[model samples]
Target: MNMQIENNFSYHAPKPGQPEIYTAIREKAKELAYLIDEKAPNSREKSLAMTKLEEAVMWANAAVARN
Candidate 1:
């Protein structure tokens, strides 16, 4: 099977003492997850994307808890 992946992700380091950055990360993660779902609903790629999304949410949650 041939798969086509399309991504346009941009990363910016979270500014010190700015908790809002975590929110932004969470939002971007949601968008990426949606794209993955739409592109490959029930496949290995979707599972991988979901795992990455889970990781991003974990990081965001950690940052939120720390602040």
Candidate 2:
């Protein structure tokens, strides 16, 4: 008898209530994006604002993971 080998893919099965967390994350990201300075008077300031927005998103995601 011959046996065939198969490859398996990993699935990201979210924990219970993760959908709510996902939704909240999305909303917060939107809020952060909008709150960021679109025109910060200069390229440097705009980059800084964008960085802050990115950090906000990361923080929100981390907070949700902790909850």
Candidate 1 on 1-66: residue-level lDDT in tens?
222211113333446755676677778888888888888869787798799789878867664554
Give per-candidate clash totals: 0, 0
Worst 10 residues of 1 by lDDT: 1-10
Kindly report which residue stretches of model 1 are placed more than 4 angstroms away from their true locations once superposed: 1-17, 60-67
Best by TM-score: 1
Q: What lDDT does each candidate get?
A: 0.68, 0.63
State every prediction's TM-score relative to the real structure.
Answer: 0.52, 0.50
Per-model root-mean-square deviation over C-alphas: 12.9, 8.6
Candidate 1 TM-score versus the reference? 0.52
What is the C-alpha lDDT profile of model 2 across 1-67, one tens digit per residue?
A: 2222111223345678876887887787777666665435557877787787678776675555544
